[model samples]
Target: MNGLGYEKMEKYYLTNLNDLLLCMKKAINFINPEIEYHHQQVAYLSYKIGIQMGMLEEELKDLLIAAMLHDVGSIAFGEELEILNEGDRANAHAYAAYKLLEKFNQFAYVASIIKYHHLPWNHGSGRSFDNERVMDQSHIINLADKVVVRLNRNKPIINQVNRIKHYVSNNKGSLFADRVVDAFMEISEKESLWLYLAYYPDSINDIMEYILRDNRLTVDDVVSLTDIFARIIDFRSPFTAMHSAGVAAAAVEIARHAGFSSNECKMMKIAGNLHDLGKLKTPKEILEKNSSLSEEEYNIMKEHSFYTYMALKDVSGFEEITKWAAFHHEKMNGNGYPFHLKAEMLPIGARVMAVADIFTAITEDRPYRKGMAKNDALKVIIDKTNDGDISKYISTILIKYFDEVVSMREKAADKAIKTYKSFTEQMKISQEDVFAMVAEKSES
Candidate 1:
């Protein structure tokens, strides 16, 4: 290992922790544009409150990450909006988020916060695990979450402040910790706070930069973090469980054949893994459809790449990765989606990614059909090349090394599948169990 604790021979890519968190928040919220800034609002409120409560900087950092990702579990259910609005139904997602995060040692504390984000503050008795009290930070998140849900962005901040205060005040002792409530009450007194929350979406990013300015993550750390999100993006549907992994593997192989430097290859692999980050917003029904999609469904699918671009475009170190990943669907003739750049405008990395994407899709099984035979898949790709959709050179390379590329894709996908199963199987409580608890709680 080198000074960064990554393998010495491998090239590492680094990104700002706050920038990465913002990208992830955007990707997660892309599930519904109506709720695109919901996580940010919650995180912003939680951070303001944490500052008022005089939390240690490290504690605030943890709280900020937990708050931003608190609702990630809701993605597992089809009725995500319903799950978020209905207190009873939402707990399942919270538990899901907890199970998902706890598996990573670095995120265990954040997992604990997410696990009980919905739990009320009727003292320590309201939520416990193995007879331990839920962390106080969870209560702060709960308060921030509830406050944001009540906000009506269309209304003026002054018009909504009294109503919001009333709601929080009424639930203060029973639903939120007294200290947390006091902190919120202190911060809520400022008119600027409400203005920031209700009107200024960009301010959240500014706050995050101020808060995380001193902390820097190495390239290896960012890669590990992106890997977590890659799982979240692909694991949303079984048909796509290994899609990103396969693309990353194939892209790396193609880049190697194209004689990309080691660092460039590594960056290409990361881009390929995250190329589908916007798919998190695509509905599962659309993704799992066995037959060809209607034009409307296909249109929705095309937006995934656009969404990927929007999410990653702002990350300081991801300019190349963003273009490579988001431009995969673009064609040489300028017939691609979200953006319509012609061959002269497209970069080599983007062209390689486009080829890798098509190759992986044809070889991978979908919910409705079996994967194509090698010769047949190759023919389809060659036909596309002839039609000016992708690069003929890359297509030729894939065909020449078909078996080796396929083997690499398969190995990478298998490892991804194992990781997915491990995450699902390690959860001690099932979604059904969470549903039962919600039902039991509702009855009482």
Candidate 2:
């Protein structure tokens, strides 16, 4: 709450805009598998819509980013419940996302669009409707977000179109604006466009290609991107934010201290960030269950690593990353599920991931149990190694850098909290600013 005006606050953040976007996207994927593809559909559809509307390139790009991140606040919803269909969830993740982004100077416009991307057009009671307030980037994103989700996940093509029509007709003067509805209708009427967006929702390179083609970033961008991804993935569960990052930091430090090459350490980092991507498919009830699970629930939990493998193993450069990240469940003595890969069959990266996974799990708080003290957590990992369940090299390395790993994770988490606080402050600045800025940004 620095009393920094919204205008000034909007202009000062996002030094690494592309990296931030990429990270936010990965977070989106971690929260909802359906949303991963949905975000891309929104971005691509918004781009095509922008072209049709004769907008500038920068405007289109921003709209694309906003579209991709529209439901990002849903990450804060804690868990993905089976009964909470896309339409049934009610935490107003959009508002939460707006507040989060409002804090960071770089994302003011982006945040604005996210906050009310679902509102209806032209229903205001004789209010001043400037570009920012009624027709900016947020509007475009809002329209695209609705159109894309309906097109992809709701029902069959004909059913989806009809559903959209009904939704628009019912909410015409309430949640959605008139022009936004028009855009949604235009998209729905075009069967080919809808089909194309629905089918090719995302390729392996969807996020990578988007950033590279749009922003011209490269592999060196991984550090910042991974940091952002870890944050978002953790956001999927209040109990898990930064869990991937913490594991990555601990694993990397352990690997480096244990005489692995910088490249191997880098690989460990990637694996750590993605180790839990499969959890997206899990229902919140299971994820947050405090008591022990039923046999069926336990079996379902055992398959997360397999899901992670299925999602990433086919990417060109991600094979190793996939194997390592997915192998977190493998036991050294040939007793893990989904693939009983024993120690000799497991690569060094897999070994590191296993250690990192355990280390972070014990060190982090969970609904079922309190986090162990740092030394105690390290001792458990060490004892596991003694039992031949983990690599001694990785375990010994963990003990060596245990302090630094925990310290860095705490720092990253603290930074995210501060960022979210800043965003919340910005959202409360003025109601007029919210409506005006969100609309104009949507239009652009």
Candidate 3:
């Protein structure tokens, strides 16, 4: 039986999780340099394994997402998510994924499968944990995640086949569910699976296109996914916790004020939400540094805008929006970062994004400084525009509707602060409780 608890994540993607999946997966992988493409590999392996095990169509879909995001808890919660059980810290990320995933209505059941991907089969004890039935799909991902992590990247994939198979055989009843291992063995002998891993990154485009080819998405899908990225980006520090929300809100207003169509405004929001996508890869030391950044650190941080461009440029529907978001750092006379594009190249949307980003940055308080008052903020922006540092057309519109646009930014920032507080408050687990839960699992 599909556990009663596991069946409800059926609407997880609201049609297709591929809506903005490319950007989301790429950003998640950026958290650690060592695990590049880790999410994609896990997703592919899990998809093939689920198919071999005869999982239903929807279940396989859910399985694919869970695998791709299996490690998200590690990225989603940082400062506040402490793993007190140092001996069993590996389970911490999985547990964190559970906490975050369960909060989303559509994605809740998917949480049931992921919360225990690191849990062992233990000769059958793992089928249920803490008196709740664990989904079999969890076992499928358990086997897939294990195999990928153990893969020796240096050696040829074909050569490691036997060793991997032998390892799976040895642990069958103890470390993995017997049925799950048997299903993996059936697919493991296939030449295609090995070829996919052997020639990775090169095979990435083909695999991603094949998997996402039939996806049906709407604007809401893109918004939901991008909001997830925004939270991961903004939640990094309280000083800038609501920065993306403010930019997104302010950009939409600027776009609307500039006579952008309704659809264009929504796209503007998507771009605003993702403008800092590359910041995910920047070092935390640079992101949360209290004082002015060192010249070397500033240069390193400059790469974030380019990285953001790279992440979104390849996404299918994000063509125009990608430039708008990525170019938020470029200047009118060609002095801005990562790219030094002159005024002649940037479009109105790109120009609007640039000014909106500045508006949010100046009005938002930081550890070392206070946000400017309305008049002060306007003067600074107007001065920059006059000096050819920003867009004249866009800044003029902003100056004309100063109260309206700035008020919109403030409202967005206020909403984001509420979210940040809720997120942090929800995640505040004490050391004693965390250790107790781990201890309970060990003895189960």
Candidate 4:
């Protein structure tokens, strides 16, 4: 890595512990502005409860950090299910949240909270390995999160307050920790806390700064945020979990062997991760289908690249990066969909993305088919070279490094499912909590 590349990576992921927290803060703000530093409320409530129960400052900060990332999975859920009815929304949000956080070992505990945020505490009673720390904070975040959701949506104030009270009462030992309920009950009695916690103006940047100050996030934090965003694209479909990562790995390796500048290769990595953001709009069934697709379904699949390009086309700092991500589908002869970008219009980085995309697809196992072996996969690419689709020169370099590229395809395929076992245990919270919270709010 060049000095500049090293600097960017350090700023985001490899950093001092203080820097990581700061990054998390900024990421939360960018990804969920509507919540408007609502993570701070979760942090505040979690800290206060931790303190009331005599936990140390360091422990409280850990809880606070976890709270900031609590709803991060929601970003992974994308735009479609985010608009679903209340019950589906809860499940979608919590599942998406868990899948996103579980990638980093540092935040696995926090991921547990996001997973179980909607579950009742007692749901795991039969399991000997049930985690106690996660149970407590999950309840705390769920309660705090509900208050924010209701208030922001302009739900009746008195009703929201009573709902909080009743939710705690109904699932004391089952969905919530007994002590957590005690603390929430005390806090619910103070009406002003809810008002202060929920209030926010229209500006997203304002909320971003608020979260940064409270959590100490910094610009370097965007690295984690970027990874989170990349994961979001894959999470929209089970077939795509490692899609970006594989594309990135393959593109970077091919770039190196092909003698591209280090800067160009770095850009390639970012492009590979973002190339499929448009796939978030495609229905999961269409993307995962094994049999021949209907023309209608095939037509929907083609729109994903267009959606990706449009979404990032206006985002600053993504000028060059967006091309590689969105142009991968374009053919050298100008027969591609979306923009139908021609060969001369396509940049070297985009060409690399196209190569990486094709190589990864053939080598990785699909829902209906086992992975094509490396030699067989290479033969397919070579045939494309003969057809004048993929360039002969770049195809040669890619096939030369086929061993490395196939390894990436293997690694990525393994992680494509977006499955989190721990979260399944936590999903139970939402079933009971939603029913209880709604009924309680109705009665009050």
Candidate 5:
């Protein structure tokens, strides 16, 4: 592509960071139904405190992003999400969030902030631990997190304002930084701020626009952000650690072979990466089940694609991507679920995604069995195609280039696994440790 062509393509995929963040907020909230909009409320409170503290526009944007994503690590907590919420300390989730964010160099600072978001500010003495000054942003997020956690949405702001203030005031120098506490105090005094938090939760993004008015993301930026969530989704279970990445690679190649434009192929890869965003809602036990799913368990599994659609459908620039990603489970015969659109309704991109999902699933190792041989995998897919459960044309294309496509999928999965291992290594934590902790906590 020429310079102008590249620029146009970039613009075609260009999206607001806020749009992506909004989708992510939905995905994270889907993990635990009880904590809807928890991230957004924290982001709003953090942004308000930042403004009250006279932070620069750029600083506020960073704080907002950091606050919104601070709990991303909690995805690893599985059923322990409620336990993590009830406890008040930095734990594995904090380290996991740090590791996840720090991979993207632009988010390194934000990663640091999230790492210590739960840390208490012991007056000025808390600023330096081991001769390092904790980022003030961490303290800001800490205070915001504390406030949002205790907020009672059912009560009127007027009734709760004084009580909330007194509570925060009591922990002024112990649980929170004095300056951050002061900023919260100043902002909380505004009835509008309290009302915004209590009533206009959806307006948090609108408020963010005032701080990030000109923010725009390139296709590459969106891909990077999606890759982060992809890890969060796949990393939830050892059985599917590299699942999304493998599917993305396979789908991109399938799109290319199907004569899609370069831009379409790129978008296909993104859709593949995010196709399982809703899988975050599935409990770890269901994902790792060795036996066939019970009817109830099967029904729960079927809801993932719907959740994926709910998360991505409203993202402004992700219209095609959302359809392709969310429709992966639909069959060509109109017998498939969440939506049962038949052969005429299923787009080519969605068809390719369905094939990619099946191909990757069977070809990749799972906890219960080894990855199938190439011929065996192809046979299963071809049988599905013959049964009218998948796209026959796409299955034929995959069969013809089976070796090349499989190579692409394996290479992509290898890279994702390597990247995952790097993060776990650096954090000095492993999936085994996290699972063990959850198991131990459950037994206790």
Candidate 6:
């Protein structure tokens, strides 16, 4: 406890909040890899526009976060992807993005910007919505998003500049704010902005680093954000409502029993929460299916752990965390879908994570089948442990204090279910305002 205990640890999760946002986007891009990515380009365009508008440094910071995640709420399997390509017009995703992101104080202004990113100016009438002030930065995201969508990625970017500029100019004071358009028009004159945008994700990191040099996050903040990640990953289906939360709880207690320090236990929780982040790539139909998957569907499912690795591998402080999360499916006998590391290669932390994952999963009820009772579930764990797959030592620890571990796991599942209900409630809020706005224009 003396080494990395809570009191002595100051910067265990110390990270530029900017880095976390990019890592989140990596999980999201898995929604559809074949499509052209726009979040980074939109962030870069919005950054340039924010500077041209002379916004405060703090404003630019939130603006960048908002721009990168403007379309985050639309992350679903199939139809949602098409909706984005066709343009949302603040009708659905923008407000939904707000509902999901507003949970974190770190995304305070960022939530607001994403909520109104698709709101039209309506000839300057867009300054406020629902009697609350709309941040001007939202309009910058709106304009940037539109510009990126209008670009034909198949052609060289320079050739498409004029057409994109014309759309912005044509929508001035209607679809876009005057100030934002004026900024875009000025920047559009420089051909370099378009070229850089074509290939600027690495540079976006540099920009975010500069803007966030003074604003590092605490461990608690990072943990709260991971809770958000779990919600995003599991919210797609009711059967998985609290799967990640349960795993995190089971992992924390199991790691503690295995003599991991408090801070190390916290890292286990992060690993558990993010272990299923790749499931976002799994189709919704597959996720919600009430029957066993065919081999083809199972093959698709196997890819998620691999993608989970790819998404989290690059995040700062997640090197060990990534393996712990991604290796939950790996076997000590060298039989995993994505990576086949043998017993010698598997770390103790990764071993704890795998057992935690199995324990929580077998105990939790899903729509398709009833969860196993204590004896039944423990038997499953024991069989796997004896087969030289999962860690026998961790399995023994889990069974030693099974009741207390079950209590903690149930409490975590209960908390996560509440969050899922809250999100569904938030998701139900009507998206009629944009429709009404459209109707008004036709009448006039």
Q: Estimated TM-score per prediction? A: 0.84, 0.68, 0.83, 0.63, 0.87, 0.90
**Per-residue lDDT for 173-204 in model 2, tens only?**
44555555566566657777656677765542
lDDT (Cα, tens digit) per residue for candidate 5, span 368-401: 7989997789789978998999998999999999
What C-alpha lDDT does candidate 5 achieve relative to the native structure? 0.80
Model 4 alpha-carbon miss at residue 164, Å: 6.4
Cα lDDT of candidate 1 equals 0.79
Cα lDDT listed for each candidate: 0.79, 0.63, 0.77, 0.62, 0.80, 0.79
- Evaluated at residue 326, the lDDT of candidate 3 is 98
Evaluated at residue 334, the lDDT of candidate 1 is 98
Q: Write the per-residue lDDT of candidate 6 for residues 1-444, one digit (tens) a residue.
A: 232444476565545576777678778777754332677788888999999999999999999988878777766212443434533244466766787788888887899988888777888788998899999998898788878777766679898887778777888888889999998899888888988887554467789888887777776777778877887787667879899999999999998988887777877888898999998888888888778899999999889999889888887767778889999999888986578998787888889888988898899878778778999998999999889889888899999989989999999998878877765565555455566665544111
**Candidate 1: clashing pairs of residues:** 13-219, 290-368
Better of 1 and 4 by lDDT: 1
Clashing pairs in 5: none
Off by over 4 Å in 3: 1-19, 78-87, 98-112, 122-133, 155-175, 188-208, 430-434, 440-444
Number of the top candidate by TM-score?
6
lDDT of 5 at 73: 80
Output the TM-score of candidate 1: 0.84
RMSD of 1: 4.2
The number of clashing residue pairs in model 3 is: 0
- Tens digits of lDDT, candidate 4, 1-444: 233353345334322334334433443344445443666666555655665666655555556666666666565554454521245456557656766766655567767766666554454441222344454566666555554555543654655777657765886666556777787677667666566554532232343334334443223333344566666666555566567777878887887777766656666776777788677667668877878899999998898888778765654455777788889888787778778777899877788888899988877766567778877887899888777677666788887777877776566555544342234345456445455544433222
Sliding window of 10 residues with minimal summed lDDT for model 1? 1-10
Model 3: residue 223 alpha-carbon error in angstroms:
1.1
> What are the C-alpha RMSDs, in order, of all predicted structures?
4.2, 9.0, 7.4, 7.2, 4.7, 2.9
Pick out the ten consecutive residues of candidate 5 with the lowest summed lDDT.
Answer: 1-10
